[model samples]
Target: MQLSGLAPGDWVTVQARFTPQAAFLVAADGRTRTYAEGEQRITRLARALRQLGIGRGDRVALLAVDSPEYVEVLLACMKLGATYVALNFRLSPAEIRTVLAASGAQVIFHSARYQEIVDGCRLRDAIQFESGYEEFLAGGPDGGELPAVTNDDDILSISFTSGTTGTPKGVLQSQRMIKAITQSGVLELGLRPGDLIYSGAPLFHAAGFGHVLYGVARGGASVIMPQWDADLALSWLGSGRVRHATLVPSMIIQLLEHPELAEADFSGLRSIMYGGAPMPTSVVRRMADVFGCDLHNGFGAGTEAGGQLVLRPEDHRRALAGDEWLLGTIGRPAFGCDVRLLDPDGAEVPDGAVGVIASRGDTVMSGYLDRPDLTARAVRDGWFVAGDLAWKDQEGFLHLAGRADEMIIRGGENVYPVEIEDVLGGHAAVAEIAVVGEPDPHWGQVVTAVVALRDGHGTPSAAEVKEHCRGRLASYKVPQRIVVVANFPRNPAGKIDKLRLRELLAEGRIS
Candidate 1:
């Protein structure tokens, strides 16, 4: 039962040998791959990558939509001991370039749809999936002996931060870290053999890949969607094959809003795992009632630290019966994980006092890639400072107060104000700009930009400002509301007072 000594690829090899005919992956397009078939493809890919001069410790960047090829590349990297760099497809060309340069990725594998963007990036040794992938695999021998991956600390993947505050730092995750997360997920989420897990989140994100890894380790089948669609998800649920699903709160809301939901059958779904943002109590109640499935809510920082806290099924029942206070809490620290609320001086804070949430465990990332200074600042001693504000109640449940940084969570996507501010600062009519999140019913929050126009320039409409950002940033990062002001309030140090701006927005004084 121990999964410690084996890496993810090792597990895949074992599963292929023992249960070769079992379905391992089913794509939205209805293409299916068994455990043995997946291992064979990964073996071929590992050999191809080795022939291209990629070996242990080398970084391989993958920029593509969700597909079986994506998982193949990931496992291939794991088998070869090369670092996997998962690039977000939503990023603009400029953003993609920055990540490629920072990761020192010598080779990139991209989907055909993004070939134009990849060409624009001028990446060295790029392999396009449409035309180059099959030929690339043909160039190398298949089912060859590979190098041994014995070191637990060898970097397995480098997941970049959301870059909300500044440049996205690469979080270096090791085999040990991923193993810890897989074990924790299996135990905490009750993953079992033969379970059919469904996931719509992009594999570039930790939550998405982590779910797949969990299914692989448990010898279960996984159904992956290229993108989130309520109608497709409903159909999958009604098929009576899906037993578990990982989703964000926004997706749950959309599924409930779908007209077909009234007739959909959810009898096969045993559990629904949600996270990445807070879930409204009302929504949580309605989902449980409609599906009659256990609801598990998890909270954690990005890829750096895997899941830290998870609200169990029993907690949901208690909250539904009138202990409503538990609805806002993120339950207790997960098994094998340690969490603490520390003051600025790194001292533990008293219960019920807001403080920075820090965690340390086997699941924590090794460090930031090539950035020792940032690694030191983020990890003190052994704990990683989450940069999230929260307070623990008397019963030890953690209640999130707010973010210590100005990162916006728009429909589970992390949108940094600084990235948006940098893009808008170049506008001809914009004198000064600040971005913040405004509460929304469907999406947890919407990006709102408050701008101060130059004296001689004419005021720009909200649509005009958003149109200017359309090409420069991702669609989710574009400001939904643009508020023009003559001047911004400043603190004593002459810095723009963002706190004051938020207050004005809340009071309806700024629009």
Candidate 2:
């Protein structure tokens, strides 16, 4: 995959010239665009943005739901060498303002539904999707020369973190990073020409954008879902048009619970890639039985780092056949990436010893935008410390222990939540589980389990749940208290929000 002189936007132009009539983007509402058509639209948008005084290094923020226009604006920014900032639609006005101020975005492009939010944020030079956006494009010359974007080091996008722990920081991604990610996707995810990729994940995040970019790089068509709808997803799968797709565990659970899943035709589906959370082994097996397609579980790559590791389809098969333990592994380091398990002092830990997960590669972000101190702390000796605690197995598979920030100290004993969650997740009654440390006057922090029971199953007593883990986990790791909920609050990326669970517990709401 020679990517020289081929930024994402430049790749789009190349695809258009070579496969003019090939479908490039299919919107959720049935609108479709060929590669040639998408290129023209992007060119016009780029020209309009340039006319508005946005050029190389200028920050352009977008606050909207997923749509073809969202992708167009992203490509437009790439074409004009402007750094694109994708604001999470679920963020509060204050949070949005903070990110905008940090990025110093010159203009904000938002959907009509977000007009009030955009107004309340008081963003300068905002363009509304309904009329202002079209009018803005109409005012610019469509065929004008775009800014030369030859430098691969130019910042391409700034993706904000999920802010689960604290305020989200803007991750500065360069053309080089995106290109590396695109190639990783092609090589690892099996993206190829003629494959129709369907992605419902929010394009504001790296996972979603990587999906779209992979399809473009492979000259494949992509179906963009504005939002996840289990019924609509089933319909698309049954349509036999979608060859591959990426989904979160929550979405997979919904699909499994949907009534139409049994009747959905998945014979044409080639691969299903899932991540964003730990998946239950039972659910993985059920998906394989139902779809009869390859199931891949992966982790590591986030906004700061591109795809770093992948548990390929073959690994899933191995787990299914009896090495069920492999399902828990995040697989080996991806191509062009180097992963290490390091101690606090930055020394490499021996294999099979738990340590902080760190990676260094072409796909890693340049740095956190404008946070030199944080950049220095996160990227040391050219390696980006992921803050995730994991140990490499003898087989070279990386097994997640938990986030270092989420580690629980119970009666002076260090306990990783994932260890308890993994044990409890296998219980028949538990559908979803998140373990958190609740401040305790005696023990410093008590191990608390917040659980959501599987549908059609009654909630098991806290004692029963604790007894199930008695043999599997250390005594200190067992949940001191279990609180059952209807559902776990999730971040935008569909990962369970442990922070929110702690808040609910503190508020006496989840008891």
Q: Of the candidates shown, which would achieve the greatest lDDT relative to the real structure?
A: 2
Give me the displacement of residue 29 in model 2, in angstroms.
Answer: 2.6
Predictions: Cα RMSD each:
11.1, 1.7
TM-score of model 2 vs. true structure: 0.96
Q: Write model 2 residue lDDT over 1-511, tens digit each, in one string.
A: 3575666778778888889999999987778899898888889888888888888999999998887888889989988899999999888878777787888887999988888777776455999877687788777685733545748899989999999888899899999899988888888878778688987678998888788889888999888887778888888977778999888888888888888777888989999989888777788888899888998776875798876788999999989999999988888898789999999889999988889999998989999988999999999888999799999988999988899999988788889888787788888887778889999999999998888888788877767876887778877888878788888888888889988888988998888
**After superposition, candidate 2 runs with Cα above 4 Å error:** 121-124, 144-148
List model 1 lDDT by residue over 1-511, tens digit each: 4788777768778778889989899988677899988888888889888888889999899998777788888988998899999997766688888888888888899988888777776555898877888888777696644544747889999998765446777999989999999999989989898788986678888888888999999998888887667888989976778999988755676687677887888999999988665454666778988889998988887488888888899999999989976877888998779999998889999998878889999999999988999899988898989788778989999987656776689899877575576567667776567788988999999998887765578777777777877877898988888888977764321235676788889999987
Question: By TM-score, who's the top model here?
Answer: 2
Give the lDDT of residue 382 in candidate 2: 82
Regions more than 4 Å wrong, model 1: 144-150, 406-510
